[model samples]
Target: MTKVYLALAHQRQRWMNDLFQRGYKKKLKEEDLFELEERNTSSKLCDEFETNWKLVVKNAKQTGKRPSLLKAIQKTFGVRWCLYGLLALVKTIRLSQKSLTTTTTGEIINLGATDVLRFDFLPQYSQYILIGPIVSIVFVFLLWQVVGVSSLAGFLVIIIGFIGYSLTGPCFGKLRNKTALRTDKRVRMMNEIVSAMRVVKMYAWEKPYASLIEKMRSSEIDKLLQSSYFRALSISSSYVANKVTIFAVFVVYVSLGGRLVSSQVFAALTWINLMRFPTATIFGWGVEYLSESIVSIRRIETFLLLDEKEASILDDIKINTKRNSASIVFENFTAAWDDVNLAYVAENRDATQRKTLENINLQVNDKKLLAVIGPTGSGKSSFLNAILSELPAKTGGVKVRGRIAYVGQIPWVYSGSIKDNILFGEEYKPERFRAVVKACALTKDIQSLQEGEETLVGERGVTLSGGQKARVNLARAAYRENIDIVLLDDPLSAVDSNVANHLFHECVCRYMKNKVNAFYESFIMYG
Candidate 1:
C-alpha cells in the first residue's frame, strides 16, 4: 500500500512537471523560451525547474490557457484537473497579494503627497490580522489532538516558541515606525527636487540641493539598516527557539526514563522535524509579514478616510428642464480657493461663509460674449472656475445648458504628433482640420516641420516653441465640434501680438462667434 502510494505520488509529480513545461512552451514565444532556457542552464537545475514550473502554472492560470491532458480521464476525475485547480488557487493568491501591495503603496504615495489624512479602512485590516492568528492557533490545536501528539513536552516546546515570537513584536513595531518616517523624508526630498529642478539649475543651487537629497537618502539608509538588524535578530531568535524546542523535547523524554525504542523515539523526532517548518513559518516569517502589512494598511486607511470634496450638489439638481434661454447663469454664487475655509465649511455645513468670489449674479445668453475684467487677485479665474464647478459654490447655484470648452493660462500639451494633439481623439475631418490649423495660425508651423502634421512632439510639447505650443493648444480647443461655450483664460498672452490678433479674428470671431465666449480678463473682439 505504502509503495503504491509513493509510486502514485511520483507519477503525479512527473505528470504535473510535463504539463507545466508544455504550458510554458505554448505561452512564451520561441525567442523568449530560448532566452529563459539559457538563463535556466546557469542556475541550479532543481531550483530553476521549480521556478519555471510555477511561472508556467501562473501564466496558464492568468491567461486561461487550456492545459494538455489525458483524453481518457480529462472529462472525469484526473490529475490534470486537480493540478489546474491548485495552480488557479496559487495564481489567485499571488494576484491578490500583488494588488494589495500595489494599492497599499499607491495609498502611501497619495497620503505623502496630500495634506490631509484619515483612518476609514484600518478596522478591516486590523480584524483580518487579529483573527487570522487566532484561527491558525485553533487549527493547530485541533490538528495536534487529531494526530494524537498531545504530549506535555510538545506543549512546553510550543509555549517556549510562542514566548520567543512575542518578544519580537515590539522590535517589529519600532522598525515599522522608523521605516515610515524614513519613507516620508525620502518622498519629500524627491518631490522638492522635481518641483524646484529648473530654479535650482538657474540659481546654481544644484550642488546644495544634491547635498540635501543625499543627506536624506543617507538618513533613510541608516533607518533601513537599523530595521534590518532588528529583522535579523528576530529571525535568528525564532530559529533558536525552534532548535531549543527540539532539544528540550528530547531532554524531557530522556529524563522521564522513556526507553529509546526506535518506534517511539523516531515517531517523536519525525513529528518534531515536521513541526519545525510550520513553526518557523508561523513564528518567524509570518510575524515579519504581518508587521509590514499592518503599517501599510494603516497608511492606506488614513488616505482613504480623508474628507473628500463634496459631490457637486448640482449633480442631484436637474437643470434646464424648461429649456431655459440662458447658456450660463450664476445666481448669488460664492466661490473660494482657500483650503482651510473650504474644509471648515465642508465640516460645518456653513453656507453663509465669505469666499474669494462673493455672492454675484451673471447670465450669458446663447451666441453672446462675457468679458470679465479684473486685476490679478480679483478672483477673475475663480469666477470661471465657479462657472465650471471647479470651485465649490458656498450658496446659490450655476446653471449651464451647453457643452463647455476651457483653455487655461498655462497651455497644456501631451506627448503625441501635432495632428494627434489637434484631433484629441475626435474623428478626423480633413476640411475641419485644415480650417482649425489656419484659424490658429499653425499652417506655417506645420508646413515648416519635416513631418508636417505628423511630427512627434516631445513630452508636454517640449519640442515646440512657446508660441508654437500656445497655437497648438488653441488649435485643440478650436477643432472641437459642438462646443456651445468656450472659456479662454488669457490664451493670447503667450503668443506674439500678430499671432494673437490672427487667433482672435480667425478662430474666436470667425469660427466660434456662434458660440458663447467667456474671456477671463484678457478679451479681444472682432466684427
Candidate 2:
C-alpha cells in the first residue's frame, strides 16, 4: 500500500511537469485532451488540468521568443482561437480587477505632484529661444498647408496668443524658483541665531528675528518681481516686433487686392504676401520665448555649474563639530580643486582672486560651545562654516575632527508635516525625542494643537510661531544620534532663555557625562 501511494504521487508530479511545459509554449490550444472512447480509464478520470490551456504555462521561462508548444498548438487549432483566448483573458482580468478594486491599495500617477513642483524645464521648452521661433515658423507653414490661406488668419491670432504665453511662462517660473532659492539662502543663515542665544534671550529679540526674516523674504520677493518685470518687457518687445510684421503683411495684402489668387504664379505671390505677416509675427513670438529661455537657462547653468551637490546624488555634507573651538587645525592635510576656481570673476573686488579658501590656515579652539560672535562685516558665520568643512577649503578638504549638526541662523521651515519638520527623516528615539521636545519646552505647546506631529506646516512653516519654529529646528538637530560636538551659530538668538539654557546644558553639555553610559548593558536600543 505504501509503494502504491508513492507511485501515484510520483506519477501526478510527472504529469504536472509535462502540462506546465506545454502551457509555456504560448499555445492557444486547449490542454484537455483524452481518448473519448475510454470513458472509465484512469487517465480520463483527471479533472483539474483538463480546463484552460494558459495555466499550464505558469512556470515557463520568460524569453524573447515564443515557446515551441504555442506555435504547434496554434498551427493545429488555428490563430482565430488565439483571439478568443486573449479576449477571455482580458475579460477575466477586468472582472478580477473590478472585484478587487475596493481592496487594492497602491496606484501610480504619472508626472508625480512632487516632481512637477520641483523640476524646471521652462528654459528648455521656453518659446523665447531660437528653436522655438524656428519651430513656430515651420508649424505655421504646415498649418497653412492643411487649412489653406484662410488658416493663416487663425495662425496669426495663435501666434499672438503664443507670444503672450511665452512671455509669462518663463518669467513666472523664474520668479517662483528665485523666491524658493532665496528662502533657502535665508534659512541657511540660522547659525547666527543659534550661537547668539544668551544675548537674544536676555534682550527678547523676537522683533529682530522677525525683522531679519522679513528683510530676507522681501529681498527674495523683490528679486522675483524684478525678474518677472524683465520677462514682461521681453515679451512686450516680441509682441511689438510681431505687430510690425502683421502691419507689413496688411499693407501688402491691401495693396495686392486682398483676395485669393488662384493662378499658379500669382497664387505663389499671394502665399508669400499672406505669410509675410505670419513670418514677422512668428519672429516676434520667437523673440519672447527665447528671451525667457536664456534667462532661465543662464540661472540654471550657474547653479548646475557650481562645484556643489549634483541633483542625482543624495550625499550629505558630513559635518564634524566635535570641538566648539575658537581655533581650527589642518596638519599635513590637502584639499584639492583643479581649475574650478577660475570659473568665477570677482570683478574689481580682488578681480583676479576667485578662490575663497585654499590650504587655508585658521584656528578656533574655544571648545565651550564658544560664541562665534563678530560684527556684521566680520566672517563670524564663515569661521564656523569652515570648521564644519561645509565651506570646503577649496574642495575635497579634510578637517580630521568632530561630529557636527548644523542649524542655520535664519529660521525657516518647509511645507511639510510638523513631524517631518522636527524629525527630518532621522531615526526615531522616543525618549531622546521627548527629551529634546522638553528641553526646547515645546512639549505641551505642540501637544495642545489638534494634529500634534501630523500638523501640516504651510510653506516655510508659515503658520508656526517664531519660538515654536526655533524649537522645531532644535528638535531636528537634537535627533542626530551620533552628534557629540554641537556647533551653533546664533541659532537661539530668537528663543527664550529657559529653553535655551536647558537644551544647552542637558542635550549638549550633559551628553559628555551620558556618553559613557552608552557602553553599559541596559541601554535599550531601537533597531
Using lDDT, give the best candidate's number. 1
Runs in model 2 lying further than 4 Å from the true structure: 1-378, 388-403, 415-419, 444-464, 482-485, 512-527
Candidate 1 has what TM-score?
A: 0.67
- Candidate 2, residues 1-527: lDDT per residue as tens digits? 99999999998788677667777886736544433455333343222212222232322325422223333234333433222221111111222211222211110111122112222333223223444445556655754563355446535654665566555556655565565456555654454566565568889996888799789878977987786686666556555644554454444455656653345324444444454433444444444444443443333322222333221211222333333332335443333222232113233234244443445553334344344445553555655545544344433333434455666667668889877787887877778777777766777887988998788888767678887887787667766776544555565667667666665566555543322111101111212
What lDDT would each prediction earn against the true structure?
Answer: 0.62, 0.49
How many clashes does the backbone of model 1 have? 1
Cα lDDT, model 1, residue 144: 47
